[model samples]
Target: MENRDTETYPLLTPLNHRQQNQTTTVVFNAESNDISPITGAGEFAREFLVESKKLWYLAGPAMFTSIAQYSLGAVTQVFAGHVGTLQLAAVTVENSVIAGFCLGITVGMGSALETLCGQAFGAGKLDMLGIYMQRSWLILNATALILSLLYIFADPLMKLIGQTKAISEAAGVFALWMIPQLFAYAMNYPIQKFLQSQSKIMAMAWIAGVALVGHTVFSWLLMLHLGWGLAGAAVVLNCSWWFIVVAQVVYVLSGSCGEAWTGFSFKAFQDLWGFVRLSLASAVMMCLEVWYFMALILFAGYLENAEVSVDALSICTNILGWTIMVSFGINAAVSVRVSNELGASHPRAAKFSLVVAVITSFAIGILLSLVLIIFRHQYPMLFSNDPEVRKVVIELTPMLALCIVINNIQPVLSGVAIGAGWQAAVAYVNVACYYLFGIPLGLFFGYALDFGVLGIWSGMLAGTVLQTLVLFIMVYRTDWNNEASLADERIKKWGGA
Candidate 1:
C-alpha cells in the first residue's frame, strides 16, 4: 500500500549505503563519531556557540588589561585628591585632560599595527609582527617627540583655554614631570597590539594587573605616607606604567611570542610613508571620537549652575569612561577576529565573527545600562558627598545609561571598519558628524536655547547617531569575499605569506 515497488527497491539511504543490498535501518547515536544530519536552526545555534566561545577568549583578557591600566591614572588622581582640593585639580587637569589627549594620539597610532600584525599572523607570516612593531616604535617615538612639546607647555595652553591661573600653573608643572610616561606610552601600545594579534593577551593582562597593585601601594606611600604631594604621585604613576612596558618587553624577548617576534630589524624603516598615511587615518578617527566627549565636559562648564553641572557631568564622564573601556576591549577583540579571518581567506568566518562580537557586546552593554539606571542614586556616593551634585547626577542618569548602550555598539562597529581597513572612510564620517554637526548642535542647545547640560549632551548623542549609522551602512554593504581577497593581496604586498 505504501508504494510497494519503491519499498521493494528499498530507497538507498546514504547513511546505510555501505550495508548489504538487503533492507537495513541505521540509527545515529550521540556517542558515535559519525554526525547525524542537522536542521538549519541547529546548525546556526551550533556555529553561534562556537563563535561566542572564540570571541570571549580574546575579549576577556583584553578587558582586564585595559581596565587595569586605566586604573593607574585613576589611582593617581585618588591619591592626589586626598592631598588637597588644589592638588586634586592639578592632577586631574594634567592626567585627565592633557595626558588623555596625548594618549588618544599614541594609542590610535599604534592600532595601525593591529591591522597589519593581525593579518600577517593570520596569513602565517609570524616574523612580520616583530617588524611591524619595530616600525610602530620608529613612528610612535618620533610622534612622541612632537607630543613632548605638549607636556612642556601645558600651562599656557590651559590658561589660553580659560582655566584658572593657579590650577593651570600647577597642572603644567605636573604635566612636564609626567613626560617620561609619554615615551612609555609610545613603546607600550605597539607591543600590546603586536602580542594581541598573536593571541598573547594574557601576558598583557597579568602584567597590567601586577603594575596596578604596585601602583596602589606606591600611590599611598608616595602621596600619603611620604607626603610628596602631586610630584610624587606623578612620578609613581609614570613608573607604574613603565613597569608594565618592561614586563611586556620581557615577554616578547623570552620567546613567548616566538616567530611573531623575530629580533628587531632596520627593515622597519622601509616603506615608512605608507604606514604613516594609514596611521594618520587611525589617529584622526580615534581623536575625533575621543575629543567629542572632551567637548561635552568643555560645554558643561559654561552651563547655568556651572558648579553643580560640571561636577555632576565630570562624575558621569568618569563612570562612562570606565565602562567604555569594556567596549573598547571588545572592539579590539572583534578587530583581531575579523582581520584574522579575512587574512586567512575565510570570508564567511569573518562575517560570522563580526556578528558574534556585536551580539555579545550589545548584550553586555544592556546589562551595564541596567545596572547604571538601577544604582544611579546610590553610586554617586562613591565619587561625591555633595547633596546637590548627587541630585543632578540622578537627574542625568537615565540619559547616561542609554548612551552607555550606544557607546558599546558603536565602538565594535568601528572595530569592524578597522579590520576591513576602512579607517580613512570612518575618519571622514566622524569629523563630519561629530565636529561639523554634533558639537555645533550641542552648543546651540546648551547656550542659545538655554537647555543647560542636558541639551549639550543630547546634541552629542545625535552625533553618535550619525556616526553609528554611517558605520552600519559601510559594514552592511561590504562584500566580505572581496575584502578577503584584498587582505590576501595586502599580505603579499607586505612580503608576507
Candidate 2:
C-alpha cells in the first residue's frame, strides 16, 4: 500500500492533502486527463495514439525516399565498375572518403536544425522554424567551406588511410572533382531537416527520388558511351545533388513551405557561432559511429592476405549501408516527433514516439537479418566473379546478419538522444564504447590472436553490444518531466513560444 501511495503522489503532495481528498483528486485527474501519463509528457500523452499514428503515416514514404537517396551513389559505383577494375576500385575509395565521410558529416550536422525546428513548430512558433532554417544554412556552409579546402589535399589523406599509389591517384582524381557536391550537401541537408521538422519530409523524399533516377541515367551515359570514366561518374552524382537542392529551394519559395521557411538573411550569420558548436557535437557523435567501419576496412588493407578480404567486406558493408538508411529515416522521424512533443510540453507523447521508433527499428532489423541469411550465397556473386572474395564473404554472412540486429537498436536510441538534447552524453558513450573498447579489441583479435577479418569484426560486435546496452539503460531512465523542462529552454533559445 505504501509503494502504491508513493507511486501515486510525490513526497510534497502527501503532506499537503488529506487522504480522502488526495484519493478524490487522483480519481478526478485520471478521468479528466486525455493522454497516457506513463508514456508521454503533458498534453501529448493525452493524444499519444493520434500523434504517434500520424508520425508513422508520414514515416513510410519518407523512409522510402531515404532509401532512394542512399542507393544513388551505389548505382553510380556500379556503373563505374563496368568501366574497368581500376575505375570500380577508384569509385569505392573516393566515395568512402569523400562522398561518404564528408557528406555524412554535413548530414549529421543537420540534427541541430531538426531539434530546434521541431520544437519551434510544435510550440506554434512556425515562423521561428524558418529563422532557424536560415541560420543553419549560414552555420553549416561555413563548415563545408573549411572541409572543401581539406578535400583539395585528398591524395595525402588517401595515402594516410593506406591506399596504394595507384588507388590514391585514382581516388584523388575523383575526390577533387567531387568538392562542389560537398557544398550541395551543406545546402541540401539543412533544407531537408527544416522541412522534416515541419512534417514535410515527403516533399524532399519525392524530389530526391526523381533526382536519383536522373543521376543514374547521367552516370551511365557519361561513364559508358561518353567514356569519361570515374571523373565523369563523380560529375553526374554532383549534378544530382544540385537537382535535389534546386527543387527543394523552389518549394521553399513557392508558398508551399508557408512559415517553415524564412527568407535568407544576414542575421543567420550572427547566430552562426553557437549553432556550429551545437551542430559540431551532434556531428561528432554521428561521425564516430560511421567512421568506425571505414577504419576497420582500411585496417584490412594492411593485412598480408587482405585483397580478397577487403572486397568481400566492401560488398557486405554496402548492403548494410543501404539497409541502415531505413533506420536513419526512422530516426529522423523519431527525433522530430520527440522534440515536437517535448517542446509542446507533452512528455507522454515523447515517450510513446520513442517506443514506436525502437519497436519498428527492431522489427526491421530482424527482417533484414533473415534477408541477409537467405541471400548469403547469392549476394556476393552479384558484385564480382572472384571466387576468393566470395569465399570470404560467405564466412562473414552470419556476422553481418547479427550486425543488422545490433544496429537497429543502437541508431534509433542515438536518435532519441538527439531529440532530448543529450548529444554530449551520447558522444561520450560512443567514444568509450567504439574507440576505447571496440577498436583496440578488434585490432588485438585480428593481429595478436591471428583471427584475421573475423576477429576484427567480433571486436566490433562486442563494442556494439556494449553500446546498445548502455543506450537502453540511458533511455529507460529518462525523466519525462525533466525532458519537458529542456524543451522549454530550447523554445526560448530559438525564439519560439
Candidate 3:
C-alpha cells in the first residue's frame, strides 16, 4: 500500500533534478503540475537520506542556538532557586509569567518573518527579507512599549490574580529589572528568524553560546559571590540577551548574510497595515500555545500550599521548557523547509519534507521521554533543594513526561501551519482546544474535583493531545499544490516576487 501511494504520487525525487531550471520552469508555467519522479526501494531510500541531511543541516545549528539561548533564563532560574524559596517563586513568576507574556507576543510577531523571509528567499526575492524584518522590528518595538506597562504594574496584576503578597511584591520588582530584557526580545526574535530563514544559524549558535557563558559567569559573580540576589540575576540576564541581539545585528550588518541583509529600507515603512494583520494572527497563534502552559504556573499559585505548589510546578515547567527548545529547533527547520519548498513551487517536496520532519521529531521526542522517565527522581535537585518541592515534582513526573512527548510533535505541526501561511486557521484551533476545551476541563478537575495540580495538568494534556491530532489531520490532508499556489500569491501580494 505504501509503495502504491509512493508510485502514484511520485513526490519523493532526487534533489538535483528538482533544482534544475527545467523543473522550475515547468512548475511555474503550469497551473497544475506534478513533481519529479522516484522509483524503487533504492531510490526511495536515497531520497529520504537526502531530505534528512537537508533537514538536519538546518536543524543542528538551529537546535543548539535555541538551547543555548533558552539556557540564559534556565540558568537564571537555577541561580534564583539556590537563593531561597521565595526568591525562586519570585524569579519563576517573573520569568514565566511576566517576561513569558511579552515573549509570546514578541516572538510570535517575529514569526511572521519566518513565513515571509523563508518564502521570499526560496522565491529568490532576497531583498524582501530585510524589509520584512524591519517591519517586524517596528511592530514588535511598539508592542514592547505597550507591554512594558505589564511589568510596571505586575504587583497589582499578580495580586488581582490571587497571588500572595510576598510573591507578588518580589516578582513585581524582578519584572521591573527585566524591562530591558523585554526590548531585547523585540529585537532578538526578528533577527533570529531572519537569520534562520536564510540558513545563517551557525552564527546565531555561536553568539548564543557566548551569551550563555557570559550569563553564567556574571550571574555567579553578581548573584552569588557579590550577593545581589534576584537583582543580580536580573541584571545579568538582561545584559546577556542584549549581548545576543547586538551580536546578531553586528553579523547582519557585517554583510555576512549577503542579499538577505540589504541595508535598512524605506520600503519597510510601506504596507504597514498588511504586515500588522499577519503579525497579529501569528501573535495570536503562538500566544495561545505559549500562554497555555503559563496558565499552569498561575493555577499552581492558587493551591493550598501555594509556594510549594508554585515551586514544584515551575521546576517541572522549566524542565519541560528545556526539552521544548529541541522541538522548537525542529519546528524552525521544518518551517524553513516547507516554506522554502512551497515558495519554490515544489509542493511534493514540501509535503515530503513534512513527512520526514514529523518522523524525525517524534523519534527524538520518544528518546527524550525515556531519558526524562529514567532521570525523573534525580533531575529536580538541579532546580530546588526543598524537600517538599522535590517531592511534588516527583509526583508530577509522569504528567511532565507525557507533556514532553506531545509538545515535541505539536510545535512541528505549528511550524507547518506557519510555513504554509495558515496562522489564522491555527489560531482558531488553539482557541478551541486550549481555552474553550482545555482550561475549563482543568478547572473542573483541579478545583471542583480537588485533583489539584495533577488533575489540572492531565486535563490540559488532554487538550494538547486533541490539538496535536487535529494538526496532524490538517497537515495529512493538506493539498500541497494548492498551498504552493498560495505561497506564490502571498509573495506576490507582499511585493516580494
Candidate with the greatest TM-score versus the true structure: 3
Q: Is candidate 1 or candidate 2 better by lDDT?
A: 1
Looking at model 1, the pairs that clash are none
State model 3's lDDT. 0.86
Model 3, residue 299: C-alpha shift (Å): 0.6
Tens digits of lDDT, candidate 2, 343-427: 6555765787788788788999999999989988898777766777789889999999998888877878888888887876888
- Report the number of backbone clashes for model 1: 0
Q: Quick one: how many clashes does candidate 2 have? A: 11
Error of 1 at 314 (Å): 2.4
- At residue 73, candidate 2 shows an lDDT of 77
Comparing 1 and 3 by lDDT, which wins?
A: 3
What's each prediction's TM-score? 0.89, 0.88, 0.94
RMSD of 1: 9.5
Clashes of each: 0, 11, 0
